[model samples]
Target: MVNPLDHPLFARVSHYINLINFLVLVPTGFLIHFPYTGAPINLVRNLHFIFMYSFLINGFVRFYWSLFSKHKDLVSGFLWNKHDLKTFWPQIKYYLFIGKQPNNPNKYNPLQKTAYLSFPVLALLQAATGFILYKPEKFGGVVSALGGMSAVRGMHYLIMIIFLAIISVHVYLVFTEATEMFWLMFFGKTEHKKGI
Candidate 1:
């Protein structure tokens, strides 16, 4: 049987890469933010840039896959409709332990789609801010538009905190509410209930 939760190999691989990139970027980014006297600051910055590029590339691949792959319908969850708006409250209540889960048979519910869709925008903001910090001369116009270096730095740090919060909630839900999803993301397929 064709498992609805089964991801294509390319999708799974991109996800893995993105996960690893996130795992590396967060710590290295922190280290860069709060540098110590003995810390290898250059190394941390290098790793941060490397993984940041990997994350961006992986995001582009996922975007391309969404556009060209056979699973366009599945990837198009980022585009929502009136039904999604109607179900949003129910989904929120379910996550908050106040109501039953929404009975959607697709891979991602409206809430999940909403959360997943925000990542790319967050990533782009992170990338732009990072590049501005990395090469202030190159992004002088952007920095000025964003209210100078200090403001850009603040925005970048704030965005990172947002990423942390979202990732924490996502991980919690995956482990507690959808353990199979964790496996499915890594292995590309999962044995789960009909709705997944």
Candidate 2:
């Protein structure tokens, strides 16, 4: 049994590490600005920045590492295509309980591809706006381009909300739609009747 040349093992390892950053960043983003948190705003800001760095570093590293990976599927699976669009209808029907699940699914379904691919993009947008909000004077041009510091803040906040919502759905789908997925992601293997 020859294993597929492109294993997702390393990419999967990087993925869980990347998810940890969001887990902390989302809460801190709200807690820092929450009127009732009663905690020092700077403390929450510092915590949020820490996770931001981790997220950026992990994302950058995974992207660069994927370039040299033998297992290209790990990197390529996030790309959306015509096939993904074709597959999307059945996935929608499956979610609505009107279609049977796809038996031999690709590395991801269309919705998963869309969600996973959007994370880094949204993160980068959030990061750029965050930095601008962090030092408006330094990014005065960007602040003005985005309308103003308040607008930048609103964009950053909106990105956070979207990230949290997508992540919540992602987690629920991974656990419920196929519990084997969780184990496969964690252990990098599963007992399939045939090949992965």
Candidate 3:
């Protein structure tokens, strides 16, 4: 039998590229902001720009592929609906140990959809603020439009903290509630078994 977890090739490629993007950004971001311990700001800035372009290209490619590809269901899964909202409370209760697993066999659990939905918006904010701070002259329009460099910096920092928190929770949930799902993301190729 074909593995239900066997995702489309584009999805797999997108996932791998996304992982690479994260790896590249994390260190680059650290070095760019924190010049402590003799870190070279110039080198970090270069690496950050390189990775940022890679990320942008990957994202654009994925967007184009999704628009034209047959596996549109995967993309549609991220969209929120009334049912997702209705199930949100139950999903929370289940995660918090106050209720049982939800009965629906959704493409994405309500909570999962909610989290995934925030990623694109947060990523855009991170990139937009980074660009404004990186070249205040070129992005002076954006910086001035946002009130100034300091405001952009503050927003960037706030978004970074929020991103980190979301990542932490995502990691925890992957190991705790979705260990099997996590495995499927990497090696497993079986359809998601119900009633787990």
Best by lDDT: 1
Pairs that clash in candidate 2: 6-71
| Per-residue lDDT of model 1, residues 1-196, tens digit only | 3364457677778878987998999899889989989999999999999999999988888887788778754445567766787788999999888999877765677877877889889999999999999999998888999999999999999999998888899899888988777767765556454544
Instruction: Give the alpha carbon lDDT tens digit for every residue of 137-175 in model 3.
Output: 998777888999989988988887886777788889878
Which scores greater on lDDT, model 1 or model 3? Answer: 1
Give the 10-residue window scoring lowest on summed lDDT in candidate 3: 187-196
Candidate 1 weakest ten by summed lDDT: 187-196
In model 1, how large is the Cα lDDT of residue 158?
96
Which regions of candidate 3 are displaced past 4 Å? 1-6, 188-196
lDDT of the candidates, in the order given: 0.83, 0.77, 0.76
Model 2, 1-196: lDDT tens per residue? 2133334667777878877887788888888667464677887899899999999989888877756656555456777767777778888888788998754346678878788778779979989988887888898887888899779889999998898799788889877876666656666664344545
- Of the pair 2 and 3, which is ahead by TM-score? 3
Question: lDDT of model 1 at residue 150?
Answer: 97
lDDT of 1: 0.83
TM-score of 1: 0.88
2 or 3, which is superior by lDDT? 2
What is the Cα-based lDDT of residue 97 in candidate 3? 91
